[model samples]
Target: MNTNNKRIKKGKVKKKKRIRISRLILVLVVLLVIFAGAGNLYYKSASKAVNDKSTKSVLIEVPNGSSVKKVAKILKEKDLIKNKSVFISNVKGNEKAKHLKAGKYKLAQNMDNNAIIEKLIKGEVYQDGVKLTIPEGMLSTEIVNKLVSQKFGDREKFVKLYRSPKEFSSKFSFLKDSRISTLEGFLFPSTYYIKKGETEKQIFEKMLLEFQKEYDKKVKSLVEKNKLNLYDTVIMASIVEKEAVNDSDRDIVAGIFYNRLDKKMKLQSDAVLQYGLPERKSRVLYSDLKVETPYNLYLHEGLPPTPIASPGIKSLIAAANPKKTDYLYFVTNVDGKNSYSTTFEEHSKNAKKYHQERNDLLKENSSEKNKTGNDENDNKEKSKEKTTN
Candidate 1:
C-alpha cells in the first residue's frame, strides 16, 4: 500500500513539471512574434516614402507658435511624411528637435520620414514668393517703384496705401502728431519674401512692424536721454544715413549737424537736394542746389519738411546719441572716408583736393568704358565677316 502511494505522488510531480514547460515555451513564442512584428513595422516607417506616386510640391505654413506635435501633424496632413506617429517618435529622440522653426515650408510628397525630419530640424523652407530687397536710404516713391518693377504690387496702389492716414494711423502711435503725412522714412529696410497672393497692406504692415520691433527699450531710452522727440531723431537719422560714408562716421556726422543746428547754420547736405530733384544725379550740379524744394537743406534752416529717406538702425542710434565733437563740417575724401574740419577754410581745402581726385577717377572710368565698347564692336564686326565668308 505504501509503495503504490509513493508511485502516485511521483507521477503527479512529473505531470505538473511537463505542463509548466509547455506554458513556458508558449510564452516565449508569443514574445518572439510580437518583437518581430514591431521591428518590421519600424523598418517600414523609417524607410518608406509617404507617396511614391505623387511628385507634386505643396506649400505648408507652420504657424508662428506651433509645437513639435503640431508640426508633425501638419506634415502628415500635407502628405509630406509617411506617418505622424513615427515622425513624432523620431523628433522626440532627436536632440535638435527643439530648433524647428516656424515658417512657410515648400515640401514634396515623395520625401521619406528621415528626409522630412531633417528638413524640419534645419528649417529648410521653400521660397516661392518674390524676394524684394528694400535697401537703406530709399524714399517711399523709390520703394514703390522697386515693388512695381518686381511685379509684386501696383505702384499707385502701394503709394496710395502707404500714404493713407487711415490705414496705419491706428496701429503705429508714432504716426500720430507726425510731421510727414506719407510713410516716407518709417519703412524698415530688409529682404522680404512677398508671397504670390500677399497684399500691399500686408507688406507695409510687416515693414512697419519690423521698425516698431527695432525701436525697443534701448533705442527709446536713448531718445529720451537725448531730449529729442522720436520724429526729429528719425528725420536726422535719415540725413545721417545718406551723408555718412560708413557706420563709424554716422555719429560724427550727427554731431556736426547738431552743432550746425545749435549755431543756426544751414544744413547744406547734397543728398537732401537730390531727393527734391526731378531726376536723381550722380553729382549735384550748381543749379540743383538752387532749386527751391521743401527737402532742400541748403535753403531750409531746420530739418526738411519730412525725412528724405529711410534710415537704418545704426543711423537711428547715431542720431539719438551723437558723438561730442567741436568739428562742424565734413567732406568725403578720395578713399570715400570722411575728412572732418573745425573751420570753413579747412573744409574748403579738403573739398578741393578730394573733388579733383574724384574728377580724375570719373575721367578714367569714362575712358575704360569707351575702350570696352570699341572692343565689343570689333568682336561683332569679326563675327559678321566670318559669317559672310
Candidate 2:
C-alpha cells in the first residue's frame, strides 16, 4: 500500500514539472515573436521614406551653430520626420551623421532618414544660389570688394556694371532719371540669395526690385508731399545713413541736413568729403575738406550729384519725413554721439571738443606704436650682440 502511494506522488510531480517547462517555452516563443515584429517595424521606419505619399521640396537652413538635437526638431517641425526620437537615435548611431555641415539645403519630405543624413554629411547644398549680404552705408566699391572676396565675379566687371547701368536705367521708372549715373543708393542693402551663373546685372536688378518693393505707394506719396525728388531723397538719405550711427538720431540728422539745404548753407559733411576720395580714409583731414568734387558738400552747396552709399529704409523714411527742428549744425563726439545746435558758436564749441579728444587719441596711439617699434629694435640689437659674442 505504501509503495503504490509513493509512486502516485512521483507521477504527479513529473506531470507538474513537464507542464511548467511547456509554459516557459510558450512564453519564450511569444516574446521572440513580439521582439521580431518590433525590430522589423523600426527597421522599416528608419529605412523607408518619411512621407512616400508626398513630394514637396522645402528650403532647410542649417544655421552656423546647430546641434543634432536642434536639427531633429527642425526636421520634425517641417514634417520631414515622423518620429523625432527614432530619427535622433538613428543619427546618433550612425558615424557619418556626426559631420553635418551648415548650409541652406533643399530637402524633400520624401527623403528617408539615411538619405538625409548622407546629404547633410556630404554637404550637398542644392545649388539654387549663394547668399550675399550688403549692409547699409556700403559704397559701390565696398560692395564690389565684397563680391570679389566672395568669388562672385571679377571686381573690374562688377565696377563696370555699376558705373554704366544702361539697361536698368531704361527698364525701371525710378532709374529713368538722367542724373542717376550709378546704382549706388538703389542697390538696397539687404540679404540676397543669387542663383549660380547669375550676372552682376541680374543681381543688381534684383536688388533694385527689392528697393522698389520697399518704396511702396505710401513712401512715394511721402516723397511727393515733402516736395522732394527721388534722387534728392536718396542722396539726403545716404548722407543721413553715414552721419547717424544710431537709429533714433537718423531723423534729427536728416532734419539738420534739410535745414542747411533750406538756408542755402553748405552741407559741410566730412562723409561727403570721404565719398569724393578714390580711397576712403579713416580720418578726414583739413586738406581732404578742400577736395573740389561735386560730391564734396564742404566745397559746394546743396545735395551731391549721386548718393554716397546705400541707405536703408529707416534713413529713406527719415529723409522723407525729417523732424521739425530749428537746429542747423551737428557734430559727432568722440564716443560717436551726435550733438545738435542751432547756433554756429555752439556747433564750433562741440566740434572743437570732439576734435581735441580725437587728436589726443591719435597721439596716444602713435606713441604706443613708436614704443613697440623701439622695443623691437632693442631686441634685435641684443640678439645681434649675443650672436657676435
Candidate 3:
C-alpha cells in the first residue's frame, strides 16, 4: 500500500512539471505570432502612408530621449504618416532607431518610410524665419559687421562689392567714376528681408535704392545751392544725424554746425571725435582730444573725410534746411537736453554745468560698476586704447 501511494505522488509531480513547461511554450508561440502580425502591419501601414498625397508642410517635432514609438505618434499627428501603430512597429524593428535626432522636421507626403526616417535624422526645414535687422545710425563697417554676423554675406565680400568703386560701379551706374572715398553714409537703415543665397551686390543695391527713395526733394536742390558734392552733403548729414537726438533739436544743431562750417571755425563737436571709435566716458579727456584724426571736430577745421555715421531723414532734411541762429555754442545736460548760447562766456557757463554733470557721471558709473562687480576699469582702458588708435 505504502509503495503504491509513493508512486502515485511521483506521477502527480511529473504531470505538474509537464503542464508548467507546456504553458510556457504556449505563451512563447503566442508571442511569436503577435510579433509576426505586428511586422506585417508595420510594413503595410508604412507603405500606405508613404504613398498618401495630402501632406502640406507637415512638421514633426522629435524631442530628446524620445523612443521610436514617440516619433511615430508625432508623425501621425502631423499627418506625415497614416498609422501610428504600424509606423512605430516598423521604427522599433529598425537598428538605426537611435539615429533619429531632436528637431522640427518637414516631411513630404510622398516620402517612403526609409525616406521619412532619413529626413528626420537630417533635421530638414525647421523654424525657417531667421532675420537680420539693420537699425538706423550704423556706419558702413557696422553694416558689414551685422551682415557677417547675420549671414546675409561675409565681411570681405561686402567690402569688395560695396567699398570697391571698380567692383561696385560695374553694376551701379551712380557709383561709376564717383570720387566718393567710402560707402559710410550711403546705406539706408531699415529692417530688411534677407533670403538665402542673396548676393552682396543685391543687398548693396537695395540699400542704396532705399536711400535714394528717402532723399529729400529740397536736399537735391540744396546740394546744388551749396555747390557741395554728394560726399559733402552725406558727410554733413552724418554729423547732423549724430548731433541731433530729436527732430526739434535736429534743425538747430544742424544750423549751429553749418554756421561753424561756413565761418571756417572749428565745429567743436565731441561726438565727432568719439565717432569711428568706441563709446567714451562721461567726459572726454584732453588726452582723448589730442588723438589726431580728420573725424575729430576739435582738430579738423571742416567736416570729416567721410560721413561720421548714417543719418535719418530728419537729419538729412536739417542738413539741407538749416535754421538761422546767431548761436555758436550748444551744450547738453546729463539727460541730453541742451541750452544754446551766442557768446563764449554764456557757453562757458553751460559747459561748466555739463562738466559737473559729467564728473558726476564718472563717479556714478564707477560706483555702479563696483556694486555690480563689473569690469569698469577694463572698459575704460579699452575705450581709451580704441580712441587713441
| TM-score for each of the candidates | 0.67, 0.63, 0.58
Native-vs-model 2 lDDT?
Answer: 0.81
Please name the candidate that would achieve the greatest TM-score relative to the true structure: 1
lDDT of each: 0.81, 0.81, 0.72
The C-alpha stretches of model 2 lying farther than 4 A from their native spots are 1-127, 360-389
Tens-place lDDT digits, model 3, residues 1-389 = 69999999999999999999999999999999999899777667655655556555566678887887888877776667777776666566677766678876777777767678766666553655446666667777878988888777778878876666565556545455356666678787775666677788878877777777677454677767756666677777888777766678888988888887778888867678877346645545556666787777767788877777778777777787778899887877778787898887787777767756755676778666465335444444533433321
Better of 1 and 3 by TM-score: 1
lDDT tens digits, residues 1-389, model 1? 69999999999999999999999999999999999898778767655676778789889998888887898889878877766777777777778777677778777878776677788778887877778889889888889888888887778889898778467879988778646588888898887789888888988988888888887744778999879989889889999999998899999999999998999988888788788889886556555556899877767888887788999999999999999999988887878799998887777677667756755675689875564453444443432322221
Compute the lDDT of residue 375 as modeled in candidate 2: 49
Off by over 4 Å in 1: 1-58, 75-100, 107-125, 216-227, 362-389
lDDT of 2 by residue, 1-389 (tens): 69999999999999999999999999999999999999879876765677787778998988767888888888889888777777887788897776678888888888998888888889887667788999999988888898889888877788888888677877678988889888889988998887788887787888888889887743677898888898899999999999998999998999998898889988877788788887876555555555678877767888988999999999999999899899988777878888888987777677667656765675679775564553444543432322221
lDDT of 3 at 57: 56
